[model samples]
Target: MAADLVRRLAAEALGTAMLVATVVGSGIMADRLTDDVALALLGNTVPTGAILFVLITILGPVSGAHFNPAVTLVSALQRALPWRAAGLYVVAQVLGGIAGTIVAHLMFDVPALALGAQPRTGMTQWLSESVATFGLLLTILIAARSRPQAVPALVGSYIVAAYWFTASTSFANPAVTLARALTPTFSGIRPDDVPLFIVAQLSGALLAAGFCRWFLAPEQAT
Candidate 1:
């Protein structure tokens, strides 16, 4: 890899690490502070959203702030990111996500890797994941085109809303879903259930990408 590409990959890894830390850490904090599941969820939702906006704002210029594999995949398909670089980005993201989860667990004095016991399965959960991921990708696609500066807040807002509306709590990023499976926290998903969530997320991301291609940027005739 070239020096520039190496730097960008490092940025992706570091940013994704921080993003996962923010999410898992916040979920742990919320679970500790509240008996009410609603209040705990609210606590989890707010910080995760806030952190996401901040991460994107700070990292956007460096590596396009693509902390999600689904987003990266779509970007590659759209020609925004080259396929080779996208593959590198996915590797970094997955590694960073696992490291971040371990860090969060350590910080909270929890086990390093827990295969989440809670079941996040079934068709309804899968559907919810699809919807959540679709909305998230669509939000990024539209905002990035019309108001580039607003992408951070727009994405944060959409995710915050999705957390409540979707049964899967909007695990829109495959990296995140995989990392969350290692935690026995409020946000954790069972390891066995990760595949379905990933499949749903990918499907949704592709659908959004296709829609954006058709409507937002129509193909030119040969």
Candidate 2:
């Protein structure tokens, strides 16, 4: 059991690290290649969605591919994961995400720990985050229940859509939001705004979980 937990933790950390690396790295690459913000966003979006699909497909069995603290929290609330393990998962994800930012910075020959100056705050952004996370959790819950095999694809697709639709570009994940704050790049968010983003995400996730509990309940035989 101990060994299994260790493996799960490692998988979570590694998956989150790779996810953040792709996010930050792609943002940097896109920024360098384009003066057009829309095009740069497109460049960032595709790679992020693609990487999520790949990582979830490859690591799903190992750690359930929960690279987000919000996901982990919802799972724990649903009793799909133990609380202790869920706490550890969040820790692993946050640290791994930060490491990923550093790795991306080094790859692009920038300082590793620059604080983000990009201001990603305001009511619109917060509401967008809540909506983004609500949709994400709902997608995962419904897909996992109805078509377990399609969860990865559905999640990847949802994120792709959310990026274009949401005001905050659908950061929906707390670990990713925190990690992005460490990068002063196209994908970065201001560190000052991280707390509210996280709160909105968690609120959205919890709300989704609550809604699904009733919506997804098994029909009682008459």
Candidate 3:
């Protein structure tokens, strides 16, 4: 069982690294390919979604495909994930994300471990994160309960839409958010702005988990 857990954690870390690479790498590629911000974002969006679908589909069996600390926390809160396991999951995710950012920088020939300078603070950005994370958790929980098989595609598609809809580009994952802060690129966020974003994300995640608990809990037998 311990060996199994290690393997599962390895899957989480590797899957998360790939996910971040997909997001940051595509954003860099998009920015280089287009002068138009809209076009650049469009370039970034599709690949991120596509890779997420692939990652989740492939890694779901091993780690429940949770690449986000917010998701892990929610799962633990609902007793779906054990507390110790959740801790390991979150640590693996953060470390994996940082490594992924470095890989992205290396691939682009950008300075490795450069801090993002983009100012992403303010109420609008914070609110957007909350909304984005809330929707993400809601999607995961509801989809897992109703149509488990379609989760990967649904999550991927929802992220694509969230990228367009949210002001902060739908950075709904804390691990992803922290990793983005390491790159001074199109997808990067200011390091200073990270705490606010994470706070809002956690709040949103917790609230969404509450709603899911009530909504998905089996009712008393007649």
> What are the per-residue Cα lDDT tens digits for candidate 3 across 11-119?
9999889999888999999999889999999999999899989999999999999999999999998899899999999999998899899898899999889999889
Name the better of 1 and 3 by lDDT. 3
Best candidate per lDDT, number? 2
Which order, best to worst by TM-score? 2, 3, 1
Q: For each candidate in the order shown, give its overall lDDT on alpha carbons.
A: 0.91, 0.95, 0.93
Show the colliding residue pairs in model 2: none
Instruction: Kindly report which residue stretches of model 1 are placed more than 4 angstroms away from their true locations once superposed.
Output: 218-222
Provide the TM-score for each candidate, comma-separated: 0.96, 0.98, 0.97
What does candidate 1's lDDT look like per residue over 103-183, in tens digits?
Answer: 999999998888877799999999999999999999999888779999999998999999999988899999998889899
Alpha-carbon RMSD to native, per candidate: 1.9, 1.2, 1.2
Clashing pairs in 1: none
The number of clashing residue pairs in model 3 is 0
Better of 2 and 3 by lDDT: 2
Best TM-score among the predictions, by candidate number: 2
- The positional error of residue 167 in candidate 1, measured at the CA in angstroms, is 1.0
lDDT of 2 at 198: 95
lDDT of 3 at 39: 98
